[model samples]
Structure formats: C-alpha cells, structure tokens
Target: MKSSYFTTLIQLLLLGAKNPIKLSTSDLAISIDKTQQTASMHLLFLEKNNMIARYKIDGDDVIQISASGLKYLLSVNQKIQSAFDDNSSTLVTGKVFSGLGEGAYYISLSGYKKQFISKLGYEPYPGTLNLKLSSNLHKQFIENLSNVDGIIIEGFTDKKRTYGNVICYPSIIDSNIQGSVILIERTHHDSSVVELISPTFLRKKLKLKDGDEVKVNISV
Candidate 1:
C-alpha cells in the first residue's frame, strides 16, 4: 500500500509540475499533503529501490520519477479506479488494527461468501487515502483469512488525529458474522467507537458480524 501510494504521489508530482518535472522534497510534500519527513522517507526508499533519480545541480536538489516509478504508477492507477461506480466509501469502524505511527488507517471486512473492497480510492489528507474495494478483490481477503494484520475502514470525520498507532478490533459486531479489524497510525490509544466509517455499507456488503475476525498472511 505504501509503495503504491508513493507511485501515485510521484506521478501527481511529475504531472503537476511545469512539465520539466524537477521538484524538491518540500515541494512534493505540499502537493501530496504529507509531512516533509514522510515524503522524504518515501523518496529515499524509492531512490534505493531504483524507482527514482536524485540529482544535485548547483545547490538545488531535485528528484525525478524513473521508469520503475512510472510503471508502478500505471499499476497503482489501475487499482485506484472502478469498473463502474466506486464504492470504497464503505469502511469498518472500531479500534486500531496493527502498525506503527498515528497516521495510517486500514479496514478489512469479511463475508460468509464475499469481499467488499474495490479498486477505486481517493486521497483526502497527507497520510490517508480512502479505499473502496470491489467484490472481485473479495477473494484476496479470504486468502488472508488466517494470517496476521487486519484490514482498514473509512469514516466521515472533520478531525483526524491520533496520539499513537491503533489496532481497532470491533468491540461490537453482529452474530451471523464474517470478519472485522481496524488499522490506525498510532502506537496505541483508548477510545470507544460509536460508528466506524461505513458500518452500514460493510454490514450489507461484506455481511459481517460482531464476533468475526480479519487476518491475513503476508505470503501465499
């Protein structure tokens, strides 16, 4: 997810600039709505990964997206759109899932016979992107049924700030359940969630319950 995000970030940067495509860390950070440090982190990783180019001409430092990054952008863009109307508006609301930092969030929903994550999504803030999963990707969730790591859900909130990384396990769910898990960007926190992003949508789409679980294996 992070890698794909970087691809989109770089692509937008390249396309938005004056066509020369020369940008500084500060410049890219502003465009992506990410902290300069976060932008730098991804940029440096892309550099080491042979996904970008770093060149210093005079006293100015510039970064350019490479073929690999462009290629990656192509793939990322594909997963960022929908076959019809994107329904990524659906989300799970609960406790934070697993991960470090108080910035990122993830939601995974399960069904007795379906998945709801779509290919279309949008970036509303610097560190966050809303995901709408498609039913086709539902199979991918099942392949991850018995693994570590939960999924993410989205909600509507004007205030988005967390003190630590959060793994929001649904304290409440339905009985005829499927699965559920939350991922936040904090180390830890305490709070009761009345409404997860799109509980209504997920309940109907993924067919989840209160006692189910969402887990995934990184490999295989």
Candidate 2:
C-alpha cells in the first residue's frame, strides 16, 4: 500500500484507536486534514488490506488497528532508526600528545592483543597514539562516547597484575586511516586525553608530531 494509507493508520493510532474505540469519519478527517469522504475511503482501504479491524458497538462505529498494522508501523520505525544510525558520525579535533610511554607495554601483552585482533579485526601496533582535546566541546564528546556502547576488550589476569577492561570506538583519522579510540578502565590521563590504536604506527604513517592537529571521525 502507499505511504498515505499508512499515514491514516498512524492517525488512527494517535487518536487512541489502537484498541476498539468509537471514532467518527468527521473526527478522523479532521485529524488527517482530509474530507470525510477521503477519510472513509482510507478506512475502507485499510480494512480491505487487513491493516485495521472495523466493527460496531451499541450501533456506533468502532475501529481498531490490527496486529498486522502494528507490525507494519514497527518495521517502518526500525527503518527510520537504522537510517539515522547509518548517517550518525561525530568529528573531533585534537592535537597529538605524548603519553607516559606505557602504551607499548599494555598493547604488547598477549591478553589484550588477542582480544584486539579478534574483536577489533586488526592487530594493533605496539604503541598508542595519544591526543589532547583542542577545546571543551571536543572533550565533552569523548565524555559522551564513554556512556555509549562500543567494541569491548575484556580485561584478563596473568601470573602477575590484573589488567582492566577497555572500550574502543571505531574511527577514521584524516579521512583515510582507520583506527579506534580506546578508553582504558585504569589510566593516568584525565578526560581530555584520547588514546587511539591502529594496525600501523600512527606517528610514522600519518607523519605526525607532538603538536600536530588532527581530525578524527568517530562512529557512535
């Protein structure tokens, strides 16, 4: 059926017609901004297509959306959500910064390396590329990303100390290089710092220095 017919079904739902409710053609026409005849025609079309069930109560017209109609609306809602998710992306600008020189030790550990390969689909380099947020707005974006779900790298224990969990968000740097922004459960850096991991040495690959500005497009 056409979208206009589905629109009428939505109008009925908004008028509390999901269950059997007394609804007049004049009322439906006003809600849909159509004439009474057009409203009646739409109702007939919906009933014939099994989108709505029509009956009577005490000689009064009663209409309700059927299971099939609800299913259609749910499917449309999912499609709309998917469309927004596909287009949703955040651009963050930051400057390259030096870390505590401990990224290589953590990244090279077998416990985290295996998960990085399996979950992230790529083996990360020995060291991480750290970035400092250029502004408070950019720092806020990272704070928001922490609340959402991302590629999770579970922590594990070996013969010695225990490692902490890490959250990674897939990102594109400079519009070409693919990487991830990682949030370590235990870290010395504050909220303004973002650590990234990639398959290659980001410093050499991107020709980056300690003060170079970069843009990362993160997919939430």
Candidate 3:
C-alpha cells in the first residue's frame, strides 16, 4: 500500500464521526491533497481488497475500514514506529499473567503445531506463557513486533473449524531462553497482554509467577 493510502486512512479514522465516513472522491482528494482520480482509484482498490467497505447511497460513496483493514493499518503503523526506534535492540518489560487455558489446546492443534516446528524451529510446548505489558513503551514495541514480518503461522481449516493466522517475533525470554512472541490473529487478550511459546515450559524454567516482571529482548 502507498503512503497516500495510509494518510487517507488515518484522515478518515481521525476525522470521521464513526467507524466509517461518507465522502466523495473529490472530498477525499481534497482531504489528502491528491487528485480526485487518484483518490477514487485508491478507494476502489481498498474496497476490492476487503480493506474498506464502500457503497453507493443514492450515488455517494460510503467508506469504512473493515476488521482486516484495521489490522493492516495497525501493522503499517508499527512498521513506521520501528523505523524511528532504529538504535540498539528493543527490550519490552511486562508482568506475568494467567491466560484462559486456551493457549495449550490451540498450540497443540496439528495444523498449527506442524508449522510451529518447521517455521519457528521448535514444536512449542502445549501451553503459552502470558505477559502483560507494564508500560506504554513496552506495549507499543509489542505492536511493532507483530508488524515486523517474522515467521508466519498461516491460518488453517480442518474438519472442525478455521484458525486465524499468527505472527511471531524471535525473542530472548528473561535474557536467556530463546523463544518467540506469538501474536494470535484472533485473541481474547488485549494489546498489552502478550503470549509467548517455547519448546519448554517458560514458567518452570524461568521460575515465573503472576505479577512477576519479565523482559523480552527483540532485535528489529
């Protein structure tokens, strides 16, 4: 996607009263300082790719970013942020948290486990270690990690149901263990809460407990 597209998306998100904003090509063009034709073309592409929802209300264009679109924009934002933090390695600090007991089951699924081994270099232990970000900076870094384009665990479907895609970032847990921070495509946790997967149980190896502060060092 072009920078203009992101600019327009940010414009809409900031200026619109609701999730979607209603506007014409000329209106969008004026907002982004682009030609009307260019604005229309970008809007069309966004609509076709399921990024923005577009329709005609008596000949006017109504546009809003879909769920996928929001996710993509988030990834783009993270990339831009990473560019500014281009110094040494990034260290994210957080506190340990208990999850809903779903991580193990999902990680154990054959569809995901197979790829975890091949792409992540280890078959993750059945469970994931959950951490809650302790600071605004750490939370921002976590979001950037998701956008870094590390090993991708693609979503899959079997006889039961469809699973969402997951993005991983190679990370050093507690300054020793090698693992990856796993961001599930569909997660019940908020952005501040991060999940990590490793070949061994992190809780036991690191002697972690709820509220314990932990740091993950990630190389961008």
Which candidate leads the pack in TM-score?
Answer: 2
lDDT (10s digit) by residue, model 2, range 92-194: 8889989888999999999999999999999999999999997898898887788989999999999999999999999998899999999999998877988
Over 1-220, each residue of candidate 3 has an lDDT whose tens digit, in order, gives: 7777767777777766137567888988888889999988888877777778887677777887788888987897898898777644678888998988999999999999999999978989899999989799888877667767678899999998999998888888898888888889999887798889888899999889899998888666
Candidate achieving higher TM-score, 1 or 3: 3
- TM-score rank order: 2, 3, 1
- Candidates' lDDT values, in order? 0.42, 0.91, 0.83
Model 1, position 59, has a per-residue lDDT of 65
Candidate 3 RMSD computed on C-alpha atoms after optimal superposition onto the true structure: 15.4
Residue 38 in candidate 3 has what lDDT? Answer: 90
lDDT of 1 by residue, 1-220 (tens): 4754665455555654222356778877777777899778877777787767788777687666677766776785677676223432222323223223222233331210112233112221212112222333443542233244443333322244323233233322333332233344432322222223323344344444544343221111
Off by over 4 Å in 1: 1-20, 79-220
lDDT of 1: 0.42
The list of candidate 3 runs beyond 4 A from truth reads 1-88
RMSD of each predicted structure = 18.3, 7.2, 15.4
